[model samples]
Structures are given as C-alpha cells and as structure tokens.
Target: MNEGYRKDIIRYLSVLNNLGGCHIDTINGFLQKPSYIGASPPVSLFPSSDGKSIGDALYQLSIVLERMTDNEFDDTTFYHSKQLKSPLGPEEVRRLNEISLSAKVTQDYMNTIGRVFQSYQLFELLSSLEEQHITLISKALTSIFPMDQSITNDISTSKQKNYQGIIEKIKQLFSRTKIELFLHLREEIEESQKNPHKSSISQATILDTLDIKSSEYYLASALRQLLSTDENSLTTLVNELRKIQPLQITQLSLLPFKDFYQILDLQANFIQMANTYQFFKEDSNSQFNISTASEIKMPSTPEIKIVDQPPDKAIYKRNVKPAPSVSFQGDSKDLDGNYYVSVALLRCNDFSEEPTFLNGASKPTKITNGKIVTFKKLKVMVTSHQQGETLFCFRFDLRRYSSDPETNPNDFEIVSSVHSSPISILSHSTQLKSTAIADLPKVTEVFPLSGPSTGGTRICLLGSNFADTPAIRLKFGNVEIQPEFFSGGTLVCNAPEHPPGTVQIKVSNCQNQWSVTSATFTFEDTNTINPSSNISSDALSNILPESVFGLDFSKTFDTNFIIKGLETASSTLPSSNGAHRNYSKQY
Candidate 1:
C-alpha cells in the first residue's frame, strides 16, 4: 500500500511536470531547468497572491519522498529525491518509459507533489475558509446559468462530457479585468437573490462591491489558473505558496492509499481535458530545447557618465567612516536593452595599480584591460524611463589597503574611467582637519614684474603659507593658469598672455582666498622693444639667475638687488624708465 501510495504520487507529479512545463534534471532538477513551458495563460488558475504556494507544495513533497526512501536513499547526500523501491505497475512503467530520458525529472516532480500534498492542512483550511466563498461563487454562477448540482463539480465533469462551450464562456468571464469581473459577479449575485433589504450580501455600496463575494470568486479564478493544461496557460504552479499555520503534515507510514486515490482525480481531470482540448494534447514535434547560440549579433556598448564623484578628501579609518561612492548615468540609446551594467574603481593616474580590497588579499585588482578596484563590482539594471537613467552607489568593503600610512599614503586619486574626478583619500582625520584649517597664502613680492605679451615667461613669487597642491592657481591680471609646481615659501608659474599693460598678479590656493601682491605685471610686446634701450635681450635673459631658472633657488635671494638690476637696465631704456621705476618700487 505504501509503495502504491508513493507510485501514485509520482504519477500525478509527472503529469503536473508535463502540463506545467517544468524541466528537471538529476540532483538539481529545479535549479537546472528554472523556466516553465508554454506561453503565458490569459488568466492563472492559482492566485498569484498566494505566492510560492505550489512550489512550497513541491518542496514539501520532495522532503516526504526523501524520507520515504529511508535506508535506500542514495540521493539524500545530494539533497534531492531518489527513485522509489516500490514495484512498478504497468501504468507507472508506461509513464516512466514515456519520459525515460532520465529518472531525475520524476524525482523533481515527486518533490513538488509531496509539497502540494503536504499542504493538505492549508488546503483544508482554504476549503473551510471558502465554504461560504464557494457558495457565493456557485450562487453567482447558477444565477447566470441555472444548474442542478454544485457548479464546482459540474465544471470539473463538464470537460469529461466535452461541454467546452460552458467552460469557454466561464473563462471569458474570468478573462475580464479584476474590477469588471468582480463588479459583474456582484451584479449577478444581487439580481439572482433580489434581497430588497440590506444584508452583507445585499449591500449596494461601491465598497461592498469588492467584498468577500467578489474577492473569493477572483481568488477561485486564480486557483483555477494553476490547472491550466493548455499551451496558452503560461501560469506556473511554482512560487504560489501562501503562508498558513496548522499545516498538518502526515507521516508516510500513516498516509493512506485513499489520499493517492483522491489526488488521482486530478490526473483523470487532466486526461479528460487532454481528450477534449486541442491544447491539452501533447505535440511530439514540440521540443523544449533552447538554442543557446543563434544568428550572431554584435553586442552593444553603452556610454556611461559619472554624474557624481566621491568627496575630494575621504577619511580612511578602518570600518569607522563611510566609503566614498560614485554615481553613474548611462545613455539608453546605446544600451540596446542590455540591463546588466558593471562599474568599478581604478587609480586615476595609474590604471595598472588598482585599489585592492585588503592590503594583503590574494585577489587581483585588475579585470580585463582596465585595472579596477577588486573591493566591489557594481551591477545595475537599466530603468524604463524616457531617459533610461538609473542611479547606483558604488560600495565596497572598507578594508585597509596597508597597515602603514607611509606605504599607501593618500596622494593618488581613485577614479572610474567611465567618468570621474581625482579624489584625495586621507588616512587620518587630523590631515583632513589640517586641510580645512590651512593657512592663508601671503604673497609679498613677484619678481620680473614685467613679461612679454606672448606669455611663457616663468616668474617666481615670494610667499608664505603656500601649499604644493593641485588646487593652486595663478592669475596674471584677469587671466588665470595653474602653476607647474610650488615649494616652501615660493611658487613658480608661467605668466599668461595679456595686453601689453600692467595687471595685478594674484595667487589662490582654492580655499576661496586670493593673495594679491602690491606689485603688478607689465606685458610688453618683445617685438616692439627699442633697439636703443640698454635693457638688452642679454640683460632680460639674465634677469633670473641660472640657479633660479633651474629651480635650485631653495635659499632666499635678495629681492632688492634683483629690483636694482631691473631698474638700472630700465634706466638705459628709451621711454619706459619712469614706468619701470614706478613698478619697481611697489615690489
């Protein structure tokens, strides 16, 4: 009896597997074949709200089957069902032979069958809960089309008698939108009963229209969707389990053969439907074989832009501070429907040396040609908006790259080539605090106060509190340019081209403060220098000593002597001596 019980459960599960289009393989049946068969149904038989109800049933069945095999379970270690030891009857043998390609599909289906059967408690609860529900739906149906017996049994037996027209009409009614279907059902129930007085059922309010009567019938239609044996029913029996307690699970030893017999009614119903409906009939030519490779199409490349970058100086405390994040926006026109996008970090200046997760971790930072931080790889889905824009924050484990700050000091900027800015990663909060309270730059003098209008004349500015950072900017009059480099107490930068007139020279450290020297720069057209002037090309060339030109002037130089030389040279000038002397004193 136990063997027969097990075999009978297998038979039903097999039928469901075939009907539901579940493809199962050995050991990992559901995992291997995750998709369902056939096109989607216009309406599902099972309520989608009762999510995973059927799958839960299948899983429960797998557990029961696993327990049933007991000592003979070779597949227990694999965590799935194995073939039963029960003697195969002719029907079981025939069904087994029909799908003899592998014994695993039977195992997978058996698991699902066990789950469904195990949920008998929940099913019983549903039945008890829907007692009035069934009556209301029946009443609604009988009012539309008078019947002598229960509408549920009639609908079931109608297929056996080839009464598809009634079923088709019922399907048409259910195919309407939920509101229309519920409202129509409510109307039919109200008209048939004609209760003039207000009862819960007779309430004509709009809110009452969506009450138990309509909702239950809608649920009934969803339940019916699970049994969709046609190709049009894309409804999957998996993932329809609803949570309910008192799931009174029966032991295999206590399980009666009558239970199997009761479930056989479903198989009979399916066979009857197969005989009546063209869709229920299996097509030998139809195959579930998916073509992995078809006509080759070139993949599309999306244009990704980083809309937001990490803060300039992110504090690097192990696990105490939030890791900086970058936001990227991709153009959908080039995405070509591909939703999987990847974003990673790379050293802004050096692509070869990627910021690895932990300083000593074995994982390589490089992926493909681009070196990306192995800390995390961001994969995001493209949205359906008109812009096709989606926001994703790049996050990764905040592991120390090195224990010593000297080895991995935060000088380099980390960025994503897709689009990003250089960000300074400070190892200590004190460094960030120091940066916030950095001293204001004070420029006392700018030597060689005059340069040719063509620009490119390297000038040295004497200043205190100057920092050698990328933020340093030098402005000759209104024209501004970044200095090549800065050292303690001095900054060297080429004067930008301006009109052949004097303009104030200002220096900025980008702290929103500018230090303007009293002296101004005079731009002179070198081509217009008078030949009679003693301010010779040699003197102008010798204006800055070789030590200063070579950037070797770490020692302080006399600003007055340099101004004296320029004044003496200007004294020999034809007409610019007065203007040169005036400019010289300001220094």
Candidate 2:
C-alpha cells in the first residue's frame, strides 16, 4: 500500500510541480529535516502515523512546488517567493499568491469526509491547473472585450441574464469535473493497491487533466467559441466582460507604444514576439513609409563564440558525465595513480558565495541551442583523501510543451524535479575517449647532451607548465624513461642506450599532449674512446670516468668532456716523434 501510494503521489506530483520540487524535494525535506510548516506528530487522517505516510509526503511536496523560484528552483520560475514577509514588492506578491492558495485548499481537509479527498499532490495539481486556467481565461477576455465599452456602466437586462447564465454554466462544468476526478481517483487507488508495480499514471493522462483538454477548461473554451461565432452574443458578452475589466482600453491601444514595449520585454516570449504592431509616422492613423537608409554599409559582426566544425572534423559536444580514473604510470616524479574529476551541473547567478564556489551568472545567462537553463561547469583535481568512494545516483528534469512548439519553448519546466540530495560528481569514466589536449607539453633542452652508448647517463631537462599536467612521461627514443625529479620548470631522467647518432628527447603529458626538445642527446660511441697518450699511472689510479660518477640531482649540468678514462702506464718510451708519451701527470 505504501509503495502504491508513493508511486501514485509521484504520478500526481509530476503533473503538479513547476520544477519537480514537489516530487523530488518536498518529501525528502520533510523526512530528513524539521517541517517548514511545523508538523509535530505528523498530522494524518489515518490512525497509524509513522510520519512517512503517503498523505504526509504529498503535503510536503505541495509546499515545495508552491515555493520554487525561477532560478534556484527551476529554469522557468525566475523569482521564487515562498518566504515572503512584510513590505513585499508587486512581483513578490504575485508569486506568493500561488502558494497562499494552499491555505484555502488545506482548510477543506479539516474533516474526515474531506480528508478522503486530501491527497497533497492531487490538490497541488488541481490548484496549479486552476491558476493556468485563470490565466487562459484572462487572456481570452482581454482579446475579446471592446475598448470603447471597457469603462461603460451601461449593462442591458439581456446582457446581464447571459452573463449570469454563463457564470452558472462555468460553475457546473468545474463542479462536474471534480466529481469525475474523485471517482476516477478512487478506482485508481484500488487498482494501484492490487498491483503496486503498475500503480503509475501514464504521462498522457496526467497532461490531459492539467492541460487545456481538461473537461471544464474545454467546456469554457467551447462556450467562448460558440459565442464568438454568434455576432450578437459576442457583442453583448464583450460589453459585459469589459465591465469586469480584465484588460483596459489603454492596455490594448498603441497610443503609448514605447511604454508597452517596455512592459512586453518583461515576458519570456518578448525576444521572439511576432506581435502585430500598428505604427504610424505621425500620431493620427497616417500611412508611414518603411524606415530605410538610402545607402548601406554592413556593420562589423559581433564576436560570436560558436565555431562550426569542419566537415571532416568530429564535433566536440561536452555533456554532464561521469569522471573516470586510470593508472597514471608516468615519468613525472610527482604523479600518482589517484585522480579526482567531477562535472558541475548547477548554474548559479551569484558567484560571491565564498564557502562554495558559485559563479555569478546574471540575466541573459547561457540559454542557447534550445537550452532552458544556465549551468556553470566546475572541474577540479583532488586526491583520494579529499574525495572518497561515495556512492551517487543521477537526477533528471522533464519539460512541458504546447501543441505549437514554434510559439512556445519545448523545454518549459511545468514539470521538473528538485532533489534534496544532490546528484554526485561523476566518479568513474565509463565512456572511453582519446585524450584531450588544449595545450602541448614542451622539452626545451637536455643538459650534457652526449652520453655513453651503454646508457644510465643523467640529464637535466627544462620547460614550463610541467606540474600543470596530470601526468608527465619522458621518452628516450622508443624506451619510456623514468624521471627522478620533475617540477614546473625542470625534469630529470636517465638517458637510455641508443645508436651513436642523436636521439630525440620527447615528453608526453596526461592528456596525450606531446613535445620534443630541439637539443638532442648523442650516445658517445666506444670507437671514439681512446686512452690519452700523455696520461700518468697516478691519474688512472685516482680518477674515475665520467660514466661511473653520478650527477647532483639538485643542480643542472651542461659542460662536455673527453671520452677517454684510463691513463698511460709509467714505463719508459720514445720522445715527441711517434711517441707513446709518458708524462708525470698528478691525479
């Protein structure tokens, strides 16, 4: 029963919530934290109240949807006002009015008979639907009423009679819809209890009830349509509806076009508005010419950020995805196998939040390519200690669409979710891709450019932006060499054996970026090595070869020296001409 009830509640909330706040946030908030509405024992119509009842969950859900603003809550509701207090602005008041209706609705559930129909999500859905219908009704009234009769007190007996009759008809239509919903809901409850797995309501069914296709809304529309066709009825209805003053004469007129355009800009559709504007060169219905310049020069194009990929090149469309870990076996001494990566999904308008790094994004935020909201991507590298193996799941948002997609944004979040628990950063990489390199790593020079062909010659390498890389590897020809020391400006590695010719010194970074040194290392051939003819026995006994001596890791070396290590024996030999010269050389 609990499973069935929860599923049904979610189904209801999916239709009701502005941004899935009710479905995702409300219940979780109630269960985990103290109730914002101050529920102590968790009020319920049932005897057993564990505080996790479906009805209680629904109630909390209603509060959440009723509270969401356009920015923090969803992409659609720009200004949220659930916490509105004294000295409110007009916009704040307007936003609060939607939530205030909760009191009016909750009052009906004070008794047992009323509590039977007291599903929080169901009421939330109905209230939101009612608000939507009211807006539609207001628009309909505004378009039909005559400007001249808008302020008139002249109400004919026949017009008054028609008005009263239509009002009653509207009441009956709405009243009947409630009865039908009540009966259908009861049947649904029974079915859901029988099979909890199939307890969900189809999306199409929920949309019909909340949308213009709902019985009462459809009936009201039919009534309006019938009257519009009948000229006399329309004339009387328009005159009567005008007295109610949904739209004024001035509001409909272009007499104050500039002011009206300013007001029009406040709406979401203002950017794409294809409204019929009646413009005249002079004020009194005079024909005007289309404003055109005699000669034209194309203005300089603005710096657009979008770059089209060439036909042969693959497109790089990044999305919020999981971060993966890989074995970072590199020549860089500092690099370890552990790495931290996350995809940031939230777009914050205020970046001054110091405790958390939220970027200040203002109006005209990233809303391109049919994107409904703005999101700031935050990528960071961390150690395993900073980010443990915390398990995380994902959350999704659903958008609403009208019959005419051209006129309305398809990504409208009439239905969306605001989870209390955050979706975790992508911890692992499931999708494999070629390493991305925005910049390449460089190896400027390798000190002591020549070494013995036997290898194990230490060389100091120099460059910049080395530590910035996640991993760095040094290569001597085909063999990947291990680095003894590495930093932003320098790296140390032992040269591997190669042919007597010069071998290129190459460096590769974590992102698969590669760079090579202009200065290459030459392997000194054994054929070039010969004992110095004037070398003494003392020098041979005391001195070691350059190959046998190790380098100072802290310092860099660049000087070149002779290849021969042994000294000549002291046995007597011939003099200067073709001499095996025996010289007294000190060690």
| Residues 1-587, model 1: lDDT tens digits | 12233423322333333333221111111011111332333222222322444443443333334334322222221122112213445665444323311122233343334343432222232222222332332333333334544433222323322222323333443443353435454455455456655443333333244343554343344323222222222121111112122122111111111133333333344444333322212451142111101111112332222322333454432321222232222333532221222334333322223433223223323222121232222211221121122122232221222233345543222222232333445446676676553445777777666767876665667767765544466777777776644355766655676778888877776434576443477899878976576654456556644443233222212222222234465322222111111111000
Write candidate 2's Cα lDDT for 245-289 as tens digits: 111121222211112222222222211211212211133123312
| Prediction 2 TM-score vs. true | 0.22
How far does residue 91 in candidate 1 sit from its true spot (Å)?
85
Write down the lDDT of every candidate, Cα atoms only.
0.36, 0.33
TM-score per prediction, in order, is 0.23, 0.22
